[model samples]
Target: MEADHEVAPPNLADIDVSAWRELETAATSPQSGFRFLNLCSVDSEARPQARMVVLRRADGPSRVLEFHTDSRSPKWRELSTKPHVTVLGFSTQTRLQFRLQGTVELHAPGSDQANAAWDKLSPWTRTTYTGGPPGDECGFEMIDEAVLPKPQDDAKGKPHFGLLIFRARTLDWFQLRRQGNRRALLTYDETGALAACRWVNP
Candidate 1:
């Protein structure tokens, strides 16, 4: 009997590296073109939770991604328990969408990495994290004001902030066009090296 044969698909390395870089560029641009991602996490009960969040940074070379969130948020708790997550980003301008999956590493306030990132943030951006617990139930007619230390005045207050870092393992890129739908899927190895990639029908 003849042995069965299996055909291997195209590898991610075969795709144009420039195109992948361009996709990352569009995702991280500040013009609101690809600012938001649908962050997906699984709860303790295995229920999925997703929310739209701004993509703060993406280092393509290092495969490191960063996003900010209040330390007191429920997503933090969920992530604390389950470190793996998926981020879906769509760009209307280019009619492209990217889905990324990775394991998360949390950066507590005052850590060296957090400090470096904090130093680069603008005052207005830092103010968001200085507020009270996100999604808290404050009285309708009540206003509670807590004085937060200015970023310049107090260097120690950076610990109150939280930075979530995700090291991506897989990326699914899709392009929607009037003629037809195009898709490409890429996977990276544990060492952040390209494992394989392929173009598939959308």
Candidate 2:
């Protein structure tokens, strides 16, 4: 039995489309809760490493997501050694959670894709890779004034700028609402084709 005003559950087709639309919006909308996600990977010691990363790109059709990082960063090294990773994000506004398991493609600094992305970055943003390698100790004053790439030296951090391209193989999507809760597992094949969809208990 259902209440008169209870809303009907969304069909799988609708959920599939709406979920991707949310991801696309999350990538471009700064205010979106999902704009920042937790990316987790395994280090050499087989320990787990998790960091907050901005969602730089999300292509629903290709099931690909992108994030920028310094090649010298520990996470970059961890990813290079083990490409498999998990990404998680939640939106309080929508009461939605997305957990995606995937592998990553590293785009080196000088690669065509990396170059195009680097060219679009503002000088200030590019300055991040100019300092000493990530995890290096630095004084607050030095971080604020020193180690910044000179404005005219646009190539200063080119060698350290890199991109992590995530190709999701599965997505666990969940939504909570006053009236009802829903969950689904969507699996994608190597070509990014939806191979399976299953609704689960919320």
Candidate 3:
């Protein structure tokens, strides 16, 4: 049985365009509890790769989403080869699942956009990219995590840090409810301009 305080069933007849607004709002605000998404890309061997990434920025007007990563990460190579990617995310609070598809643009540390994002990172977060290149081979001996080199300033790890900007072309939004489900696809043009928003079978 559902809890007494659970949200009431949704009405499929009504389509809420605010879903996109809510998603952007949630992604930009960490307190909203929807700041994480699964970023999927295709590797050199044509295999799909997926990983959880924090949502750094979401611009509805431009249909762009930004996230941070280490320059040496495997996903970076994959994305460099195949710029197209799919992002899957869910908000447990709203019971909404979003499938986003987009092309990626990587910004190096010195770029204004990358520098702005780098300046906002806390010391600890910056330290994450300070270690040896991601995916480097380790010998059979155990290593001390405490002795890892730490970056003293943005300049130290800036070379290894990267910012990934995703230009979204489409979004498939699905809402789950006990009574019924609702789904819609919001498509954008090559320039990231909204082209159409239409409802489809869940």
Backbone clashes, each candidate: 2, 0, 0
Better of 2 and 3 by lDDT: 2
Tens digits of per-residue lDDT for model 2 on 23-84? 89988999998999999999999999999999988998999998999999999999998999
Q: Each model's TM-score? A: 0.80, 0.90, 0.83
Judging by lDDT, tell me the better candidate of 1 and 2.
2
In candidate 2, position 115 carries an lDDT of 94
Q: For residues 1-202, could you state the per-residue lDDT of candidate 3 as single tens digits? A: 8653375634432333455576578766886645888999999999999999998888777878889999888999999889999988888888889899989999866889888999898887887776678778867464777665555753578888899999888888888776667678888898766688777889
The lDDT of each candidate is 0.75, 0.89, 0.80
Candidate 3 to native Cα RMSD, angstroms: 3.8
Using lDDT as the measure, name the better of candidate 1 and candidate 3: 3
**After superposition, which runs of candidate 3 have C-alpha atoms over 4 Å from their true positions?**
1-17, 138-154
Q: Write the per-residue lDDT of candidate 1 for residues 42-104, one digit (tens) a residue.
A: 988999999988777777766767888767788999999999999887778777787888999
Model 3 weakest 10-residue run by lDDT? 9-18
Q: In model 1, where is the ten-residue run with the lowest total lDDT?
A: 1-10
